[model samples]
Target: MTRDISGQIAVVTGGAQGIGLAVLRKLVAAGARVASWDANAALNETVMAGEDALALPCDVSDFASVQAALDATVDRLGPPAILVNSAGIAGPNMPVADYPPEYWARIVAVNLTGTFHVNRAVVPGMHEAGYGRILNIASIAGKEGNPNACAYSASKAGVIGFTKSLGKELADMDIAVNCVTPAAARTPIFDQMSKAHIEYMLSKIPRQRFLEVEEAAEMILWTVSPANSFTTGAVFDLSGGRATY
Candidate 1:
């Protein structure tokens, strides 16, 4: 039960708000020195100002930005021993046929490719340190595709695949790479969704409610903790009984 990450350097993408911010708060409470990498630099700075954390302006979709953020984190808090890929966006909700091509590209770029960028940038340091825990934020939609959210669902599916592949590649080491498939949480991401889409999501959950950010954070913290020594290339579900698999 002692999932302490004390003294560990942690990096959380999209740590400015929502699930990412929740995870960052928990990491700090667990005694980890966390660097919050967010594209919303101003909001990140404002929110991280009072916490015992670092806010780094980073757009995870860009490898250059990811590298710079990693450099800054290493210089400030040493190589991150824990990484939580929480940076993501829920693109406009619409049927696949109606989904804008541009929106699809943007969604994948930020959600799927962005996860790759951050992981790629941080793993080397963890490898050198001989210790690391990576937790990627996937979605229940990835498992049971949401009806009008093709891009979001597809991108999250890619995250699950990416996590599994990376986890296997690093299984021989102390590093453990894993991801979580969470049901819809009522966060800022909701603003991008239509009212009917939100209702549809809520109805799909057996719990008949949305996921809580803190609940998501708790699972995320543990997944990236030292206690998660054996589990790798696995998907932890926070889907409220919505995911059959």
Candidate 2:
């Protein structure tokens, strides 16, 4: 339970709700000065209003928005020593042939390109500080390739690959860059998925249940903690026996 991230500055993207919010709350409880960045301005303000945390409006898909949020975070809480890149979207599920091109592009923009933008913006500060931890949230679909959710699966796959490449690039530093491939959690993201698609995902999980955000957060907290110093460019599996490799 000792996260060893006390007094650190941490940023959790998509922190207004779901897994991001879960991780943000955990970081604060572990004594980190936390910033919650999300595109939902009103929801973010409302959710973070009661907590001792900074809530910033950020559209991760846009580099300018990501940059502004980073600047505000640094100005207010100092450079982030920990980053949880949880901002993502689950585009509507459909067969690859029926999926709209626009939807595919948008999903990639947020889930893949957005990961790159946030990581790219934060790394320089971490490099200068000579210490940092980063955890990018990916999905089991990225590894196994889920049916009817081609965009989400593909975008998450990109996250896995990006995490590996960036983690290796910064391996010489004290920074640890890693990713988690989680089984589907019953979050608001499920709202974008069809009932059949959701059922399909659950059936694939040998645990026979959806993942809990808190369960995911617990693993994420440690993965981004100072204790995780030796591991980088690795993928942590949170798939509840669903991941074979």
| Clash tally, candidates in order | 0, 0
Residue 224 error, candidate 1, Å: 1.0
lDDT (Cα, tens digit) per residue for candidate 2, span 1-245: 34588889999999999999999989988989998889999999876653446899999999999999999999888899999999999999789889999999999999999999999999999999999999999999899899888999999999999999999999999999999999999999999889999999999899999999999999999999988979999999999999968
lDDT of 2: 0.93
Residue 110 in model 2: lDDT: 98
Q: Rate the local accuracy (lDDT) of all candidates.
A: 0.91, 0.93
lDDT of 2 at 122: 97
Residue pairs clashing, model 2? none
Provide TM-scores for the models: 0.97, 0.97
